[model samples]
Target chain A: MGNQKLYKGSLQTIILKLLAQNDKMYGYEITQHVKELTKGELKITEGALYPALHKLEAEGLLDVEVAKVGNRLRKYYKLTENGTKETANKLAEMQEFLKTMQHLVNPKFSLE
Target chain B: MELTKEQVLQIDNYISACGIKYYDVKMEIVDHFASILELRLEEEPDLDFKKAIVEEHKKFSNNGFKKLLEIKTDSVHKRFFKSSLKHLFSFFTLPKVIITIAIFLGLQFIMNSISDTEIFFNILQGFALLLSFRLLFNVNMRNNNKISFLSLSITLRFFNVFHLFTILFQFLDNINGEGFNNIHLLAYMVLFLFYWSGEYVYYQNKKEVQEQYPNVIV
Candidate 1:
């Protein structure tokens, strides 16, 4: 919870995984969803979330859809086909990193 | 708690006053602010609308909105460049390659047939005039309507500037009767094709934006 810096590198992977599971999400929806799922242990700030989204979008990993809801236009971010494919790779990379970190922290743990 | 019309307008004004000029970026930011404000109000019913907005705005501390605008602008420029590069490379693809070859040969033939360099310069001048007028007209239209410039508009303007530079080069290179050779003509045609491809891509982007926001006349 206090290690936001530790989570920084995994943010993109986390987002790709989330979008892989859910079809689409907006900025606030994403932050709130992450907070709810993590029981407030992790918080995705707007500053971090937006730049990540824009970077993914520019990289062609995500597509955007703007819809008029009530009186304002809401922009939704969904994974592109490329993004769907990338999600698997990113998740695998994160999984490997997590295993490495676990082994480093718990020295007595066996690789098997 | 849904935001009222006036409340939404207030949020929009706040975003604009923060220097986020692009309409697309503004819409996204306004929506984010609205969502956060609504959630805050729902959690604490006693919080006033303005107070909730201020609370939500505080979340984007350290001039986060400006950073967001910078990111949005960068993303737009990258998208435009990527799409234009895609179009530029498309000429080398299967069926399109044949068209490109034909256009090249046609330009070569025209250069060979026209002994008068004046006619060739006239043609170039005419095209330059037409494109300049088109660029001016579009810019004037957008300005008059207070429409925010999109990435496509920025790309088109960049091309217009490049095109003007090319015209200047041509003017400077003008010699008495030593007209353009076949190689020069081919290069000119390639440049023309590049400009046309960019224009076509901009047109496609404009069409998509118009469809996306049918309520707004883009």
Candidate 2:
């Protein structure tokens, strides 16, 4: 959860990267996947996750498909072509930002 | 483990309040929630059923659902705005404005070309007719959804009818060599002034009404 807080700005990057790897995913499945990958250290709250997915869909970065599974209908979200390019750019931007923050947080000692 | 009829109805009402309007869709969601609760009861037969249902519901956050629904509503609002702009442009497009100006220029040319009294009166009547229609239509468009169309049209129609009497008086004045003066154009000018003043009043009222009843739906 502490690590998750640090990666708040990169949540969209993480979501985009995950969708780029898979065909599509429903809300619950995405939350479960994040929890599994983080070994329970980070649990993506459904409250935070669904809004991001909906916003991405609204921005045309994601496409949704509703399918009936058993008795319930689940909305699945997948990245669009534009989303793929955006994901790469966002990841690179986050990496550069993270490196800059690291330099600021741990300034190197001068060799006197 | 059957849900009481009241419990089922409570679920239906909750989903409907959330904007899931279709009755069948509400029932489907209610059924899903009820079944989830029933399943929980099966694992622990002594568990408080209502508490279990609420706990299960707490898993799906309300803000998350509302935010998702807002995305859909926002797209609808965007499309509504786009369509409104298209309609507004169609009515007052640059071409339409140019055409109206050309017609005015033509009328001025005809007036200069033929200094005959009958022809001049005819042109004056034509100008009055055009003014009548333009005033009414302009008012209608400016009012838009703010005022009811029936009341607006009736008011404009009354103005149109009374305007004929004013035109007749102006026509009689024209034949008497009293030349087209601004006083003769008072009807149209008054209508335009009324429209502008009405718009100011409407906007002020709208703002006051909105502030007074912030939660009321227009």
Best-fitting candidate, scored by TM-score: 1
Tell me the lDDT of candidate 1. Answer: 0.77
lDDT of 2 at B178: 51
> Deviation in angstroms for B175 in model 2?
27
Which parts of model 2 are misplaced by more than 4 Å?
A: A108-112, B1-14, B17-50, B62-68, B79-218
The alpha-carbon RMSD over the true interface for every model, in angstroms, is 1.2, 9.3
Tens-digit per-residue lDDT, A1-112, candidate 1 = 7788989888999899889889999988899899999999999988888989999999999998888888888889999999999999998887787788779999788345
Q: Candidate 2's residue-wise lDDT over A1-112, tens digit each?
A: 5667866666788799889888898666776688799888777765567657756765778876655454344457788999888988988887788777777776573212
Best by lDDT: 1
Write down the worst ten-residue block by lDDT for model 2 chain A: A66-75
lDDT of 1 by residue, B1-218 (tens): 89889989998887778787678777877888988778777898787876666677788757858788788789888987887677557535677667878977876677678778668756865675566576568654555575565665566667676457566646754653465566566656666666666666666667767776666666
Q: What lDDT tens digits, residue by residue, belong to model 2 across residues B1-218?
A: 66666766666566666676533123334655666655666787787755655565577666624654555445434433443345444455577567655655665566557756456655556655666566556654555544222212333443454456546656676576756533434443443333333433334433433443343222
Q: How well is candidate 2 docked (DockQ)?
A: 0.17
Pairs that clash in candidate 1: none
DockQ, structure candidate 1: 0.70
